[model samples]
Target: MSAFLDQLQQYIERHALFKSNDQLLLAVSGGLDSVVMAQGLQLLGYKFGIAHCNFNLRGEESKADEKFVRQLALSFQVPFFLKQFETSQLAQESKVSIQMAARDLRYAWLEEIRFQHGYAFVAAAHHQNDLVETVLLNLVRGTGLAGFHGILPKQGNVVRPLLFATREQAEDFAKDYILRWREDTSNASNKYARNLVRNKVIPILKTLNPSLENTMKSTAEKVALAEKVLARQVEEAKSKWVTEGQGFVKIDIQGLQSITNALYFLHAILQEFGFSWSVSKKVMESGSGISGKIFYSSTHRLLKDRENWIIDYREVAKFVPVSILPTTQTVRLLFGKVLNLKLLEGGLELVTILKSKSSVLLDYDKLVFPLTLRSWQEGDTFIPFGMEGEKKISDFLIDAKYSLFEKERIVVLQSGQEIVAIIGCRSGQRYSVGQATKRILVAELVFIG
Candidate 1:
């Protein structure tokens, strides 16, 4: 064995990613690096199964690669698994980039098989060159330190034993073993970003320093260490500022500025609220004190409140109010804010207006015939829902800390021209149940604040 292979063997043995009795699932693409990885693992004496994905992008070339990996696995008397994918179609359907789609499908299938067949871990051939290229790509794309962490030796159930090895090292081993590996013609085409980096960018750098790949890989290792420290800081900041309530989290915008990775911290916070990258950016830029101002995402909305941001579930279903036929039993209006109802008090027989309030549970029997629930009006006033006197619908809102915008859109319950309930905030104290009243009108407002 060559000195490089001897070192690689020792590196794998030291990691102990796989045991003598462990079964590993290796993702092979019939490329030089993967072939080297498979062969190297075999030499190290670990039992493994080879899995290949034929994305069908290269027509006959893809099938050819699959055939090579299959035969190679057979030669070693190991089991082989192969799957064909219509990657382009799936990518379009999923609204994701083709590369992302392929990755999602590949690992999803690997885990499924691993669970079914009892595999220790999924292994992929990600050599040092791939790590350097990935770090550069993410840097050019405006990524934070976390992005520069690059490929890990192991993530969850997937392991990359060859991450410490360079492409040159893998190619040298392939040559020494007399291994035949098929190369994808597209790799030389430069149509893909990674291919362009591999062919055009790295070559230019290699000219200046022949050890550019190794140097870049070493830099990635240092960046990974720095990124870990930054991640811990972000986690601490997140715990300090974010509070969970019911179905949403309240983010303190002012406290976020203290975090070193503010952008990453905001991104992770939005992610926890089910927002995507585009929506997360919008929410971050919206700043604070933007009450009722809303930013929409695929799955949720970031709603601004005083001193905080709220992630609200944007209900896709239309609000269809249930029909309520007037009965002696009081009807609950789920749609419109105001409920127009009649109340018969003492024999004095004064016009009483019932409005929405927290404590005003109206007597279902006292609500008069043909009560209608509808939006409030400009002249709306109710004996302020639990006070000794009447107050303008607008003035009641001001007392409740409702923003100016909320005052314009609030629905008021009216009986003819008289204001009854204000949906949620308060009801007319005049219409409240009193002594000597035979029955009471129950009108309540359910507020989705």
Candidate 2:
């Protein structure tokens, strides 16, 4: 076996990436690294198939790459899967960079194909230099310890058997085997940040330290080890600070402040929620007065409550205030719920309002047309059932045994300065269907989840 193949075999063994009998699905871009990996895996007598992604960014060039990969698979008489993506459009829609979009699209399709074909593993050609480049990119992007941990050899069913090899080794293997592969012109272009790092920054860095990739790889592994230790520590710290609920976490700021290097510890906790170092520190230093201060991630949120930090995942269905019209019989509410509004014909006493809180009978004459359905806010006052005076919406939720997520999810039906109903909860006394009521509006709230 060649030295590259020997190294790959050792890397696979060391990482325990896959079993001898495991079928593999290889991600091949028709590049030198991937071609070398495919050649090496074939030489090792491993049963595998090739998969290619045509990103459609380079038009004809993308097709050429796909064609080369298909031919390469056919030369080995292996099953080949070809997929195309509108990478730019995907990026725009996902609000991510084209590179990120392409990576996401490629992996998703690879996993899908792997699952369907009963492939035990999906292998990618991410070599040593690529690992170093990723760490450098994450460093520039201000990523924390986990980011410096570099790429994993195995993540779920995806494995990187060639991760121990370098770019130069890959090129040498392709040349020594007389293997042909397509070159992407985009690699030489510095338009993308990664391309800039590869072509411009790495060369200068390599001049100073010829073995930078190996050196950085060692350093990254150390960081990964440190991250593992920190992760254990963070878990203990979370036990002290974070109280996990149905869909949210309540972080005790007071509990965190007692620890040494609280800010650094806080960063580790907030990192999972995608909070930046600055924001994490801000979350640490924020005082009790900033109760409403909110830090947002793409999929989650951290709210600064008086003595605690509130971390919550965003609802799949967004909360939007749909107009409640008189003619409308039913309206769709957020999170798979429905609001049914109907006129109560005759029997309209406040006795029925107390029977079922979910379905409220309210005075139709008291409610104004075109009422709005919205989430509760601080200081929003309504005469809650059994209460003579108005109570703050926040206070009412606290008394309702509502969890943080439930409190945040509570919707209020409003008409002018009054709350017509607190949907899915209590009835507003101002709109209560009293014994003297002429008309009654039966507002029934149906919760889907």
Candidate 3:
């Protein structure tokens, strides 16, 4: 057995990447590194199959690469999976770079194939140099401690068995075993950021320390260990400071402020919600500032309240004004909720139903047909069920102590020009059932997952 095979087997065992009996779907791009990994796995007698993605970026070259990988899989007498992607088109549609789109497309397809074929893990040929480049990239782009650790050995169902070896080692192993593999010309172009790091940056750095990859690997292992310890502490802190409720996450500002490097901790907590480290820093700095200030991410919004920082998912689509006709029995809200309308006899029976906040009983005759259900706008006013005087929706929300996130979600049911009810909250006095009321319009809000 070759030294490379022995080392690969040892690394896989040490990491417990997968059991010997476990089937692996190897992502073989027909490049030197991936081809070398496939050879090593085959020599070690591992239960594995080959998967290749033809990201249609390089025309004939891409097809040639796919054909080579297919032949290699056949030579090994293993199951082969091939996928073609309109990578350029996908990048434009996703509004991301070509590399990122290709990566997403390949991984998603790999995982899909893995699950369908009962593969235990999807193996990728990311060696020590790739790990080193990733860490450097993270540092260049500004990353947290987790980023310092670089690529993980086993993330989800993907495994990197070759992380123990450098690019030089993989090349040497391939040459020693008389292996032939296709060379991606694009890799030598240095047009991509990764290629720039590989060709220009690392070579310059290698002048100072020839064993830079080994050194970085050691450093990453240390950082990964430290991250595990910090993760435990973060979870503990989260339990004490973070309160996750239905539709919102509340973090105790005082508790966050008391922690050392509160911004780091805040970033750790808020990163999952798509909040950037800079935004996390701003949130931490706004601790002593006035409440109701909001910070937004692509997927979520962070509100700085008096004693807490609240986070909630941002609704992407604007709420279209939904018309609820008098004859309409049910209407679905913008979110996954149902507004069920029923005409009931206005009597003392409604007195018991009125106690439930989810349902409101209003006089049918008082409301205009085709009542509009829309998000509350600024300067919108309505009279509370028991009050004769009008109140601004903003003032109503404040008096009710609704959080900024809750206020954002509040929708009002409008009849003509007046807000007949703040859906799932208060009804207008003019629309309330009275002694003279003959029919009641029962509007019940139904919550659904």
The prediction achieving the highest TM-score against the true structure is: 3
Scored by Cα lDDT, where does model 3 land? 0.90
Cα shift from native, residue 291, model 1 (Å): 4.2
Best candidate, lDDT: 3
Better of 1 and 2 by TM-score: 2
Query: Model 2: which ten-residue window has the lowest total lDDT?
Result: 346-355
Kindly list the per-residue Cα lDDT of model 3 for residues 1-449, writing each as its tens digit: 87888899999999999998899999999999999999998888898999999998888898899999999999999999999998999999999999999999999999999999999999999999999899999999998888899999999999999999999999999889899999889989989999999999999999999999999999999999999999998998999999975457899999988999788789899999999978888888899999989999999988998788999777645678888887899887755677888898766567676658788888898888889999999999999998999999999999998888777778889998889999888889988888888888888888674
Q: Estimate each model's TM-score.
A: 0.74, 0.75, 0.88
Candidate 2 local lDDT, 1-449, one digit each (tens): 88888888888888899988889999999998889889999999899999999999998899899999999999999999999888999899999989899999999999999999999999999988999889899999877777787798888989999888788888888888999999998888999998889988999999999999899888977887887897788889988888864346788888988888888888887878887787777777784465677777767888787677888775445578878888889987765578888875665544545457578777777788888888888889999877799788888777775656567677888897678778877788767767778877777887665
Q: Residue 321 CA error for candidate 1 (Å)? A: 2.6
Candidate 3's TM-score: 0.88
For model 1, how does the per-residue alpha-carbon lDDT over 185-221 read when each residue is reduced to its tens digit?
8888887888888889888988899987778767777
Candidate 2: stretches off by over 4 Å: 92-95, 287-290, 313-408, 411-449
lDDT of 2: 0.84
